[model samples]
Target: MNKSVALTGNEAVATAMKQIEPDVVAAYPITPQTDIVQYFSTFVADGQVKTEFVTVESEHSAMSATIGASAAGARAMTATSSQGLALMWEVVYIASSFRLPIVMPVVNRALSGPINIHCDHSDSMGARDSGWIQLYSEDAQEAYDNVIQAIRIAEHPDVLLPVMVMQDGFVISHAMQNLEILDDESVKKFVGTYKPDHHLLDVKHPMTVGSLFLPNFYFEAKKQEAEALERAKKVIQEVAKEYAAISGRQYGFFETYRLEDAEVAVIALNSTAGTVRGLVDEYRAKGLRVGALKPRVFRPLPHEELVVALQHLKAIAVMDRAESFSTHGGPLFNDLRSVLYESKERPVVTNYIYGLGGRDLTLDELRRVFDETLEAARAGYYRNRVTHLGVRE
Candidate 1:
């Protein structure tokens, strides 16, 4: 039977992990991500769950331990944020290249430089190309469901890729909400067991993993990895359908609200999407033709779904919490533009850098985003490139 309770995004991750019943959990506490690991640690201590929680020294070591456990043919999980994620970069790439299906719950936050503890996409954006399947959650409810679904997607037989379930740092990660908690039996049935066909530490087989590759054959190995990722896109949809069958909660590559006939729309991910939905409601009530699109999954780009959803829109606003500083364009903007490159006719897709470095984005900012995009649609004149919103000189 389905049961419900109020849980924060971070807490819900811990709860879901209990449901998945991982054999080992290696994690070191980091702000925003701390509560998740802490709750799991308590579960470990209280005997509510039979799982090993390895407390490590640093975030780097935290992920390293998780890699070791996962490679040993065990279901492994970990949680981290900003600096912690940055520290895991090198190993993250290794995890994907080695095809280890490790899943991490990342409480998304701004990377340090000026030193901030608030939410942003900087951490995940930094590792976007590290070959992990990136899934963004717009609220605590979605956060709860995605973490469980991520495990199924990552460990699919046709695809063995690491998955990152990203939730907004302070905004959603810490915000309390009513979440339907799946019972352990149902979650177990949904996620299933981790069956590693290629486990490195199989004492019976004693096989090889991550062997050195020469320049001649390195391309072939990478080619296989690329194909596997493409396979993952479809596998994600299948898992989503299966998950809905069991839980009665529907999910997809992206969630659309009044996007079909809308002329202007804003595409966003994470907790901010909830805020944008509210603003879109206001505009809709006033007879303004504006809508919102929340991407449930980011990596592998979901090109077909995105193009179809966006094809009818006149103007589109893309929001990014992290700056691709060197590129002079936000990461989401850069990615969206690339995704739409081959389309015969595409909307005037513009990027908005909002809520960066912990800057507050109120309803006023959401209104401003819709207004600007609508005005551009009306004039039929706007740059087919990145834009900065809620940012002033």
Candidate 2:
């Protein structure tokens, strides 16, 4: 059974964490993401959940504690934003390399230098290669749903990697939205219990974690980790199918809206997808052959599926919320273009970097992007391969 609720994205995620009721939650406070752990800690204090909430000194300590708990065979979880994630960079890799299936909800914020606190993919996109499975949510509903599914995905035997669920800071994180939530028992049944086959506590095994992997074994160990991520694609789909059966909402690698017969489309992630979806319908009503693609799972980069879905389009504009500073284009654009290179008839793809430091992406700017994409479709090539949207010149 489902219950209709009005809650902020952070509240929804905290509520989900309360339902999952993991063995341990080790976290430090950071803007936007602070409320998630704050709310969960209250759940622990109130005795609603018997979770061991560790109040760590720093984000690094938070992840370190989580890694320790996960290594000790406890179902561990954590949450962070921007600098907090960057601070945990070292342990973030270790968590995955150690095969700890810890789940985290990251409220995406711009990485500091200018010291801005707002929505941007820079935080999560910066750690794209750290071996954590990444799931980006469009709004509060998806954020809540992804967190629940993350537990199952991370704990899968074949893909024992940490998972991070991302929602745009202050945008989706603070905005209140109406969303459907599964009953507590239903979520518990869906996620099940986390039972690892091996852990530090297993006296019979007596295996050591975080042991030095020298030249002889490091390569093979890394190869195995890479293989596990590849295996996760299938496991993710399987879990989505089961989740859909229970939740009545179907999920996939990337969602396509009016894309089947469209000649041009815009691809985006996070909250911007909602804007694109609305624009897609408006464009369609005007008899324009336009569509949208929202990538749900970013890491493990579903290239093969994306290629098949996009190969037919004449042009595409990939809206990136973070700049990769590659001098070529944003991170999503670079990866997407590289993948499409394998297609027989490649689409004229362009990159549009937007919404950095929580800057608003107005509907007018999006309309222009779609218009440019449509123009490129007819022109057979775009004037500029890379573009910055909504930026002050």
Candidate 3:
């Protein structure tokens, strides 16, 4: 029922967007993420899809246009990377606050200062608290799949929130990989239709979308938004289960690789998980009890699930591609550490910030990371809680 094809991550996401064929597609061009919209634009130009493609001048306008479209009860989508995401900061929160079910595919790239167009989690990590559901992908296959699933997740009645599906720039975005793609009709049926209960275009109901909430009312509204995000966790799982039935691939908040019964393990997201998995196999073959954890859903945090999975381990090394500049550690490290704090028996957790600006994470460096974690497990203490890997001495 599916066809096997080789596609770059950008192409794969583009293909997914084509299949979903949202009512509106509004986006501006940015490296790594540009090709996704570019490919979809071709679908529009060729009459393959009847999506109203908006050619925006800036990322901010792109998001504003998407929010407008979604508010009008149209299923809207967009894509961005690096500074483009940063530019959409103001409207990004607006999209979520208004509870528009907009789906966006973000190609992860380092934020600029010295100006580098390369892979890193900084772009999306910076927006963690902006009230959007976030999903990270390890490869082209997951990127494609996540985009399709995001439509259902965002539009769920209980969880009408924007969703950001992220894939590593250059690493996953540009690299080619073989992936299974569902036929267009199947995807359409799986996503169904987008019929919002309330919209600006609903003249009979007539309501204000971005109405300002005074201090007395704002707190409760914000609380409701938080609850909606919490509800999204269950909706995400339910969607994944349904998607699995159709695609034969199962997904969860996070993936555990030989983690049950392992004493020490590495935790990461995006394409780095591939490296961790390969090294995990090598370590296991060498009679070591090392494993890996790849987090797929990040926004809802999945604290309880992660705590249950990690509480048994003696030590854990969290790999973060983006620096939090918190001095304590990166974003992922701090979040995981906070989650483990609630555990009855917490592991000795350390942080490794690596692969910034597209620096490759070699297996040798990963092996050393594992060895350090194993040593910490045996000694019951870590030499350093935070480290920057592959940096010049």
Candidate 4:
């Protein structure tokens, strides 16, 4: 049985966290993400959950504490956003390098310079290569669901890596939406328990977790980490399949909307996918072969899966909420282009950097993007491959 509720993304995550109720939660306050931990603390104070809530002073300390807890064989969790994530950079690598399955809920926000607290993908996108399994949510429901799934995915025996479940700041994080929540008992059963073969707390079998490896062994260890990431792709699918048996909501590396026969399409992540889906319907009604691809699992990269979904298209546009500053294109665009390099036939893909620092991406602009992509597909060449949408001329 399921219960329907109107809850903000943060609240939904907090509710899910309460249900999962892991052994530890080490969190520091950061906007958009602050409410998630704040809500969970209430659960702790009220004795609704038995989680040891550690209040840290900085995001680094928060991540460090989480890593420590996880290394000690405790199921650990945390949340952060924007500069907070950037501040945790050093420990972020350590968390994955040590193969700790720490789950983090990151409310995406722009990295600071001019100092903005609004929604953007820069925060998590910057950490795309940090060896964490990343999941993006289009709404509060997906956020809650992904967090729950993340626990199982990260703790899988084949993929003992950290996970980051991302939601757009202020957009999905603050906006309320009606969602179906699974029963607590079911979530608990679904997530199961975290049993590590080797943990610092296991005094009987003493071991060093963060031991430094010399050059001879460091490279081999990195190769193993890479292999673990590849293994995670299968584990992610398996966990999602198992979760679907309980939740009735199927998940994948990415979602396709009206893409079966689309000649032109836009690929995006997070809440922008919702907007794209609406426009995809409008375009379909107008007899345009346009669709959208919303990537949920970002970290494992899902290259083979994306190639299959997009290889048949005539042209495609990748909308990136963050700039890679490569002067070439954004991170996702580079990935899509690189994946198609070996294909016999591939779409003329372009990159559109949009919605940076919370700039609104209008329907009209999305329509223009699709129209431009369709034109390029027809022409069989790109006039300009990289563009910045909604930016001042």
Highest-lDDT candidate: 3
Residue-level lDDT of model 1, residues 347-373, one tens digit each, is 778888888877888888788788889
lDDT preference between candidates 2 and 4, better one:
2
Cα lDDT of all candidates, in order?
0.86, 0.95, 0.96, 0.93
Ranked candidates, highest lDDT first = 3, 2, 4, 1
Q: Which whole-number lDDT from 0 to 100 does residue 9 have in model 2?
A: 95
Total clashing pairs in model 2: 0
Clash pairs (backbone) in predicted model 1 = none
| lDDT at residue 152 of model 1 (Cα atoms) | 93
What overall lDDT, based on C-alpha atoms, would model 3 receive against the true structure?
A: 0.96
TM-score of each: 0.97, 0.99, 0.99, 0.99
127-232: candidate 3 lDDT, tens digit per residue: 9999999999999999999999999999999999999999999999999999999999999999999999999899999998887889989999899899999999
Q: Which 10-residue window of candidate 1 scores lowest in summed lDDT?
A: 381-390
Of candidate 3, the 10-residue stretch with the lowest lDDT total is 207-216
Higher TM-score: candidate 1 or 4?
4
Stretches off by above 4 angstroms in model 4 are: none
* Stretches of candidate 2 exceeding 4 Å from the true structure: none
Give candidate 4's root-mean-square deviation (CA, Å): 0.8
Error of 4 at 175 (Å): 0.3
